[model samples]
Target: MRWFRKKSASTTKTIFGEYCATSSVHGVRYFSDPERTLCEKFWWIVMFLVSVGGCVKLIESTWLKWNLTPIVVNFENQPISVTEIPFPSFTICPPGKISKLMYNFAKEAKQIRNSGAHANAYGSEDCFSTEFE
Candidate 1:
C-alpha cells in the first residue's frame, strides 16, 4: 500500500462547512472537524452547552438583582456652615410620613423644648418640625 494518497475531487467545500471550520467561537472548529471521533464531538457539544448555561444563569441573576433593588437616597446629619445649599447640589427627603428608624423629629423637638434658653426662640420661629409622629 502507498503511504501518500492523491487528493480527491469528490470532497467539496460548502458555505456552512467553511464557516464552521473557520468560526471564531471556541470548540467550533474541533466539533465540526470530519476527522474527529463521535466521542470527541459529543464532548465538545457538552462543554459548549455547559458554558452557555453558565453564561445564561449569570446574566439572569444579574438582571433580577438589578430590577428587584429599590432606589435609595442616603443623607447624613453633619452640620454645615452654609445656611442654604447652592443650586444643582441638593438633598433628597422622603415623601409623606418619614420612617422613625431613619429620623426621629419628635426626639429632636423634645430636646429643643427642654432647652429653656432656646425654647422661646424655637417656638417663635416657623418650622416644619412641628409635624412629627
Candidate 2:
C-alpha cells in the first residue's frame, strides 16, 4: 500500500504558486496596488473639501441675504415694556403683547421676502415661508 501520494503538477501550481506569488487575483491586486490606493485616497480628500466648501458657501450666501436686507421695526407701533422680577423668576407679558410680537415678526419676514435683492439671492420667493398669517 502507498503511504503518501505524489504531488500533482496542476494542483501544486494552482494552490502553492498562485497563493504565494507576488501578484494576486484581479480584485485583490486592484485594492492592494499602492498607486491605486493613493489615487483613491486623493479623490476622497478632494470630495471632502468640495463638500465642505459648498456648505460654507451656502451658509455665507444665506447670511449675506439676511444682513443686506435689515428688518426695521417700528417700536412705537408695538411697544414692549420690560418688567423686573424677583430672583429665579421671570416676568410674563400679556397674550396681546405676544401676539403683537409674532405679527411684527411675520410682517418683517414678508417684507424681506418681497424685496428684490433678498428674493434673488435666495432664488425663490417662498424661501423664508412663515405660517404666522
Candidate 3:
C-alpha cells in the first residue's frame, strides 16, 4: 500500500514535469528538461536571475513613486465634523441587543436557501428598534 501511494505521487510529479517542459513560457522548458547540458542549465539560471532582478527593479520604482508623491487632503478651510458624515450603511448588533430565542439560525438559513436570495442574518428591525437607540 505504501509503494502504491509512492508510485501515484511520482506519477503526479511526472505529469507536472511534462507540463513545465511543454509550457510556452520562455526558459521554463530548458529549466525543467532532465537531459539539459551544463551550458544550457547555466544559461537558464542566468535568465531566471535577470528576470527576478527586473521584477525587483519594477517593484522598487513603484514603491519610490508611491512614497515620493504627496497626498494633499483639502477640508475647504472648515472644521471637520464626524456628524457631517452620513451614518454607516450597516451596524453590527451585539448578542445582548437581540434576543437569542427570537433569532433562529437554521430557519433563516433555510429561508435563504429556498428563496435563493440574500437575507440579513440578523433582523434589523428587532436590533435597531427605537427603544435600543
- Identify the candidate with maximal lDDT: 3
What's the TM-score of each model vs. the native?
A: 0.43, 0.29, 0.38
Tens digit of per-residue lDDT, candidate 1, span 1-133: 2333322322334555677798999997777689999899899989998999999999999899867863433364764433254446778886776776677667677666456545477565444335444
TM-score of 1: 0.43
Per-residue lDDT of model 2, residues 18-39, tens digit only: 5534554334333333556678
Q: How accurate is candidate 3 locally (lDDT)?
A: 0.71
**Model 3 lDDT-worst window of ten:** 124-133
* Cα-lDDT of candidate 1: 0.69
Task: Give the number of the best model, judged by TM-score.
Answer: 1
Ranking of models by TM-score = 1, 3, 2
Pairs that collide in candidate 2 are none
Q: Which stretches of candidate 2 lie over 4 Å from their true place?
A: 1-36, 71-133
